[model samples]
Target: MSAAIKRYGLGILAIAVTFIVFVVPLLFMALIAMKDRREANRLEFSWPTNFSLVENFQEVLSARKFMLVTAFINSTILTVVSVAILVILAAMVAWVLQRRRSRWNPTINFLILSGLIIPPAVIPTIWVLQGLGLFKTLTGLIFIEVAFGLSFCVLLFRAFISSIPKELDEAAVIDGCGPIRLFFRVVFPLLKSVIVTVIVVQSVSIFNTFQNPLYFLPGDSNATVQLTLFNFQSQFTTAYNLLFMNILLITIPPLFMYLFFNRQIVAGMTAGAVKG
Candidate 1:
């Protein structure tokens, strides 16, 4: 009884804290988004009298000649292509690193893991991309996203892959299956949970990212959803209503994705923690 009380108490406290920290700010943003520009500019925490949500939504989407729509299309393309490549590459690399035993394993692991710690050398990357003729292009940004997101996804995949049995590998090999066939046919299907987790988590990360698109793909036609926030913000005059509405817009897809895949995320993250 006492333990139950303590657990429930802690859970309730966490809920309250989360509500205060996240929900309050989100509610404020929604309120401002629903207000007219004049009331929204006041930035008060009061209920709005004149709701202009539809107006602001339309204006935000229509701003700069439907740039938000274009940004959405660009962001979707970036997220989908980059994440697909990332999943396949990361999975293959993690499978090899986990399954194979080599003297160079530690060195390889260190090199790959270093990507997580290293700050991107933007100017050098740009120079290299320029030499390769990929600068200021979606292709360049896609590569950047893949490189930056690789280490974490590899770690997740490696952890989950470890939980898979070696017996399956041996059985597949004995049955005349090659390495690629073994992975794609037998082992890959078992990775559904972790794959879903990686897809959801990395999708959110890539979709919400700002600086990569801002620096690499500066062309307005290639703008990402995050870059559309600049439409409402400027040097002097800021459209607060439209700004919050834009925030409301960009925040929805990821929020829905996370909520939908919440269970898969937890299960995948904990796949290898307990070994029988």
Candidate 2:
């Protein structure tokens, strides 16, 4: 075969491999969600024998109406507030770090980078929050989400800000603009693309987080969506049909967000690499 034909053949093979590795498992989950408990347990690839999507969903939703509703509300509030704070705070800090040169800048950068490398001390965090009387509250969970997500968001924003022209800041300063005014008016507007990217990525991650909520905010009263998975599982056995339905419900919002914002994520990630 010609070189061009061989290259095209290899590309097709790679695509096929990727589909098998990623798409196939997602397809299986979708199929299982639509199947009966017996069929789901068998884990077959064949079409579902009995389609009871509505019934399964109703069972899961009716498990604990008040608790489920409250959990949904808590999750929404935590994810939205945390992501908003992360984007704004990280963007502002990154803008200054990129614009100003100082010995302290490297130290601050290193501290932020350390968050990604170190494992959180869960018990210590709980102890501190309890002492502050912030334990088992939705607001406290929001703070935890922000703490975990801040480092990565700052890194992303800093990389993007490095590509912005410092001359813009100089001109703004020349126009008698103060630092805060300059950032809010001039720099923040230019960060719209990266903000959208951060929102899409961090919003999904914070919404689906299981560990923090389970350990830090564990209780029926303060449960988030991820913690609600336990409602379908018991010590003896799990209700497979209802569990799958709950999984399906929880998966939809993030899946739709990704599908919608996929283009923006690609553009934001590539923006710095190309421009900087």
TM-score of each: 0.96, 0.93
**Could you give candidate 2's per-residue lDDT for residues 151-243 as a string of tens digits?**
999888988998999899999999999999999999999998899999999999999999999878988988888888899789998767677
- What C-alpha lDDT values do all the predictions have? 0.93, 0.87
RMSD of model 1 against the true structure: 1.5
| TM-score leader | 1
Model 2: CA > 4 A from native:
274-276
Cα distance off (Å), candidate 1, residue 42? 0.7
Number of residue pairs clashing in candidate 2, backbone atoms closer than 3 angstroms, sequence gap of 3 or more or interchain: 0
For candidate 1, lDDT tens digit of each residue in 157-260? 89988989999999999999999999999988989998998899999999999999988889889899999999888899999999999999999999999889
> Least lDDT summed over 10 consecutive residues: which range in candidate 1?
267-276
